[model samples]
Target chain A: MTKKVATREAYGRALAELGKKNSAVVVLDADLSKSTKTADFAKVFPDRFFNMGVAEQNLMGTAAGLAAAGKIAFASTFAVFAAGRAFDQIRNSVAYNRLNVKIAATHAGITVGEDGGSHQAIEDIALMRSLPNMTVFVPADEAETAGAVEAAAQMNGPVYIRLGRAGVPPIHGEGFRFETGKAVVVREGRDAAVIATGIMVTVALEAAVTLAKEGIEVRIISMHTIKPLDVKTIVSAARETGALVTAEEHSVIGGLGGAVSEAVCENHPVPLKRLGIQDEFGESGKPDELLVKFGLTAAAIAGAVREVVKRKG
Target chain B: MENSEKELAVLKAAANEIRQDIIRMLGTAGSGHPGGSLSAADIVTALYFKFLRIDPENPKNPDRDRFILSKGHAAPVLYSALAQRGYFKREELLTLRKLGSRLQGHPDMKKLPGVDMSTGSLGQGLSAANGMALAGRLDSKDYRVYVLLGDGETQEGQVWEAAMASAHYRLDNLTAFLDHNRLQIDGPIEEVMSPEPLADKWRAFGWDVQVIDGHDMNQILQAVERALTVKGKPQMIVAETVKGKGVSFMENQAGWHGSTPNQEQTEKALAELLANKL
Candidate 1:
């Protein structure tokens, strides 16, 4: 049953539950309600769910206004539109004011597949993290995405929850807790640390399992919250492991790699190799092909870890 | 209460106080947008004093109306309105933009008392306003949401996006004021980017529209009152105003959009503002 649930569907379910609990919780979408899976919210709370059409900027601004009116607004759109098209609105209207607006941007990173680079948001985390008060999150799977949606509802201020378009595996357990700014160590190893976020967390876990067969123990940590990052977990992981590899479905320039580097720079600097899209626009393809092309597959994670461990040796 | 008579007196007094505060605050800051601030002062004054149901004493009160300054560079106007409405002490206005001052260069809702949303970047405020209005409808609350936009700010694509959404949602509880001062930081709005046929644009978007003199307290108040009577449609009040409404030499001057008044100019502006005993 869980195998078929896309993170987008989980988001819809979570939003319905959130709307039930909090009367102040309102959903706004930029005409991607069905695609982003916010249609359930619209059906359940017709008055509360607003389809702002293809206007990402208005969706952000309207969310900001709702927040000011004392509502926790979750504005939904494609990650590219939420982060790229409406960057200023999210920055000024929402984050700058510290308005309680959750940006649940779907189709994040290369997972957007055939829609191509224009729709795939590869640098959302970097863009959001750069904003002072913006809290960035990238959930790994459907269960984790559900937890993230619930968590974002409870948390104040602006939160960017990046979800993918494709049907991701239900990797996290039912009772798994998703806390803000905390890293979830999915698998433990000793030879190298594979710190990953969003959909890449699954790849990191796979890489660890594959590497374990080769007698190379790789630890996988789902660093979901990219901003206000889980430094303690990362620092200890680096210190204990001696080598590290950062993986994300975002740009190598500034997403998870940049965040992990900042943490390592402050505490324990180690031999680190970053695996992500290397600062280039993605092209139309199947999800798997895109992931492989962008070097965001389990193979890439394993290669990065092996390379980093080799450098350490 | 004679709504117009009461509103006129209130607007007359509040507008003067706001103007005085803008001049003094900008003069003291030595860096601020006085021209735009002055242009927005009267509209903000009328809204705070007459139109909106807001209590400054309990600013975060659930039922109170919300106002967002999308053109946030004009913080002095908003600060003055919030202060004059008893959100904070008038003395705080003097410390405008100073270090440790609650008032920053732009409105920061987290720091200030009555600020509905933080806005500085153009084209974001209307979206925030849409959020509030939608929230109000969701919560079964009738509290209206208001936003102020600069004429030049209308050129931003986001503003149009917000307009369409507001109308589609039939957000009758939302009212937006466009300070159609026809001037921006660089020069006149027409020269910068003509936002002309503004009313037609809003009308085409399905919003109930009104064009009025923004500085005229009676007209401003009337437009706001008329917005309430319109059912199932949002209202856009396009207020034709000078870049700087009060004070000689500054009115209609594009340079004053962001330039702080010199000490001598401050003294002169203050004198002009106080001559009417604001």
Candidate 2:
């Protein structure tokens, strides 16, 4: 059995580990340190951690400022607050300036569970990906989260790392290598491809297995970085597979699906189907129940894969 | 250090030149903010000339003091100051708001050499300034960070959020100036949205507040000197200024907030500024 670990937990641990090695590392949070998991970094490096109350704009602005003074700054908060409340600050102060600020946001997508629509950042991927100088990362598992966080720290520009609340099955082993703008191929096949990001990667892997039992061999591609997209990999997948299905724990509009579609249409046109929240707000429900209600299960991904394969004819 | 008699004259002359740049740039660009840029000319002049420890040759020197124009609509003031300080050629001032020009409508730190931060959207500069101050603390750098905010720009909620963070972090290395010009794009700041009791608001947010005449070069220099002694809190200099300074017709006129001077008006404004006996 695969051990389950939430990407947010791995993010916090990675930050704590990073602080010891890099003296320039500083963390700022909008009073959600515990939830965002920057508390781990704060506990270890009290002098470098800043709690900017509940002000998300200031949290981003402060990170930009710190980056300006030659420090690698990480600003953390929930996805909704970080992307929605502080959108302008992130756009103008961080991305426009191309500062070395890492926006490590947690509680993305519907998996945020009980807090309801107000808390779920269903459109964060879209919001972050739209910025010009922003490098967007949606790590699928704990390993990817750690890799993305460390990679984000090493870079000298604005980055947005989307982390999740619920634990998912591990997709990578100890030897998993994280490369920016490079998609990792999990399970290769000949029939069609499944492009997934965030929590949807695990679900797509499960769906690929189920499709295999039905005599359909589907390729599973884990698209970790949403922006600076791996266009080469996506074009190759489309050309080789002849069809593709995109999955993400986010709105179908402007999420992984939209990004993939844009790439495929311009480079290699393939029949594609998107499986996601479908331009709608999520509500109060257990994460499991919400996944089922929103049709975000392995079965849904499998259905979309079959439909896209059929359209390839 | 007290400003000697000769030093004041140089600052005054520089400020007068910056005001002329503002009028010339706006007139050349055909459309740009002149009022706030003219209002904060003296303050920007003081920071660039007397207060800030900056270098024109190597503007990106890591240890150099940082200045962020929070009220980015007043880019002309900052551009003029940077040009006069020889960050770039003064002839580049005419390229304001022009396509393919380094001088963008708002400050673009990437394209411009001396810009510490890119600011155009309101209420974001103070937060970036606070971050720099925090970074200085983390890196043990003694370089101070300064930000200039417009009075009307305070209406942005992010400014207050930044205000709270500035105090919470105890950033003594940061100093913010409120260019309280009283006029915004729409009309009077009070009529549009009263940011009245502005001094109390800054003090309440934990800044050591000081009120001053923004155009007075001596007062501008003194306020910054006083800010250096502040130990734990950020300093907020509430500068009382006219919407437009120097030009007789434009001074205190709300209509001049964003309007550019016509060729005739530009010549007249320049002539009046040139006739100053300061």
Best by DockQ: 2
Candidate 1 per-residue lDDT, tens place, A28-54, comes to: 888889988889888988877878887
Global lDDT of each model? 0.86, 0.93
User: Candidate 2, residue B241: CA error in Å?
Assistant: 0.6
Give the per-residue Cα lDDT of candidate 2 at B60: 83
Q: TM-score for each prediction?
A: 0.94, 0.98
For model 1, the docking class works out as medium
What DockQ does each candidate score versus the true complex, computed on alpha carbons? 0.78, 0.91
Best by TM-score: 2
Residue pairs clashing, model 2: A65-B131, A65-B132, A66-B131
* lDDT tens digits, residue span B34-68, model 1: 88888888889888887789887788887888888
Question: For model 1 chain B, where is the 10-residue window of minimal lDDT?
Answer: B1-10
State the local distance difference test value for candidate 1. 0.86
lDDT of 2 by residue, B174-234 (tens): 9999999999989999999998899999999999999999988899999999999999999
Superposed Cα deviation of residue B218, candidate 2 (Å): 2.0
After TM-score superposition, the amount by which residue A44's alpha carbon in candidate 2 deviates from its true location, in angstroms, is 0.7
Taking all chains together, the TM-score of candidate 2 against the true structure is: 0.98
